[model samples]
Target: VDADTPSACVVEREASTYSGNRGDAPNLRGPKRSKPDASSISQEEPQGGATPVGNRESLGQAGINPVHSPGPAGTGSQPVGQEAKELLLFACGVCSKRYMCNSKLVIHKRSHTGERPFQCNVCERCFMQLSDLRVHQRIHTGEKPYTCDVCHKRFNRRFSLKCHKRSHTGEKPYKCKECKKVFTYRKNLNEHKLIHSGEKPYQCSKCSRAFRRPETLKYHQKTHPETTAPRECEG
Candidate 1:
């Protein structure tokens, strides 16, 4: 039998049904059962006893539904298949986010704890994950691994390169909930949200003047470069 074959696929003896006619020595021999087709069997791991594989109703009763999980890193843009794969069981204590591996769960916990174990030697900046620290080191190394195919533009991060492609494609995925305004980047949509909320979070320290955006406050500070004392913003 193939290792991938479910235990339920193995042939089991069928109990013989007794005829209503006078007591014939209860047939000692049971009916022979044929083996199930391997192709028809589901590859999902069975829960509890030897329940028939590929039975969605049984799986639902056991609360064990097949779910797709992200494959190993650098597996490409396509989604990983759900066949013969284990579901994410390791969960974060803080947020209840699930991960397939325990190591991934350990790293995820750092987010809630604000723990950064990986440090950059050059600038002394800390990161929760080693991968993030390595990417941050690219600032000193000036290495842009990702490049655009259309414009030949280079970016340090793959995500930056992906966002740059949206500009070339004229794809504006982020939209403002207030006025139906669209933006190519999420940061632009976040900045536009300040206009609707009337929340001026960035304030000029010297002049006590507040602005909707940080860049506006930064530009406003140029006029009072001589002022060194920080003042509170007026309501």
Candidate 2:
């Protein structure tokens, strides 16, 4: 217990015993654990007026850092050990998704809660993240950061630029599972799926005619133009 005393190893030693009848040599020392007296431990101090190595070395071994040690680079006023530990603790309640910090988890929870804290002053439109709000503000400012290399057309969002790049690449990534017809865009492929299902979602207003595509229904309406020629003057 004295700071000056050498560190003790935590091992259990068995007591040595001898039988009196046999001529076996008796053990000189039975395992006697001398407990340090509390009064003597309180009185003892480091010999050369120097700091104890046992405390410092034990702290280093237990992953505890010294208060005076320089913090890790770019930690910026935050304790590195605590920041690293916080980076692992934060997790989303709904999806169980892990994030590096509480702030990130707070932002991610908005997806489930439908919480839009950041709002645009000009448009009054709300966004879950500050980055999304910043990007939405570009719509009013007409600031386009992404550009298509093939067509040289600019777009505000990188997703638009990626879709535009497919025009030059001819990448038909979307394929119909039923007919195996390929399409460059997912929306077109979704529309193609209705053909296999024979789903006529668009119906003519004047007639019972229905079509899979809206444009086809629009064209069909032209054939039945309500007989608008005065209805044959009531014959």
Candidate 3:
């Protein structure tokens, strides 16, 4: 949970040499890191300090370029240590703290990472990292930070915002070639294809009826007392 009041506007902004590594998610530190190129050196993390960049200049804070340290110049980022002239920039907007090494910087970056590492073992879905997964396990304890930009809708992740955007745009880029029926997105296209193909991939073990859509199949299972026809016949 964030401590800063939502009404609090940024007081000051500073720039420094602390663009932390972004190979992995800052919030979701995986059990093992993906193997990176040998020439590449992941920064350990920089010392802590406070160096302002600018205040209230744009829609968001100004961020320096981020990458792993190297031996010398001739590339985008600076070489390891101070030998590189490029100014290292690192700081957390939430708390006025700057770091040099990518490690500490990543830790600072975690606040912005909005990492949700926790996941449901039964569901096999991934999250930001273990700690976040643990915190989210409480969702099985009921907690929600998500808020709806429109009427009264809220969700846990930004992806939900993307899903909700469709409602406003009414843009369905995906379309069925056989029927020319447009859909919201690619996943919908796959689901829609089942309709024309008459492919009832989802079957209810509790009952004998088959369903083209997963949700439809789920709803049909409710009538286990007798053989009820699936309303998703439109599928």
Clash totals in order: 0, 0, 27
Candidate 1 lDDT over 1-235, as tens digits, reads: 7788656524232222234332753545687677767664556455568777657688778777657544569867644555323377787877778888999999989989899999999999999999999899999999999999998999999999999999889999999988999999999899899998898889878767899878888889887747457888999
User: Tens digits of per-residue lDDT for model 2 on 1-235?
Assistant: 8877555442211222234334574545687788879767655785664445556764676566777677779977755775666667777778888777789888888899999999999989999988899889999999999988778899999888888899998899999988788999888888899978989899988889888888898889888855556646564
Q: Is candidate 1 or 2 superior in lDDT?
A: 1
Over 1-235, each residue of candidate 3 has an lDDT whose tens digit, in order, gives 3766443233221111122434432443457767856434333222363233332232133343335335357656537666542344665567756566666666556667775455577555666556556555645655545666675576655566677778888988888999999988787899989878888888889766788788988777765676666677564
List the lowest-lDDT window of 10 residues for candidate 2. Answer: 10-19
- Between candidates 2 and 3, the one scoring higher on TM-score is 2
For candidate 3, the per-residue lDDT at 222 reads: 69
Better of 1 and 2 by TM-score: 1
TM match of model 2 to true structure:
0.44
Candidate 3: what lDDT?
0.62
Decoy 3 TM-score against native: 0.36
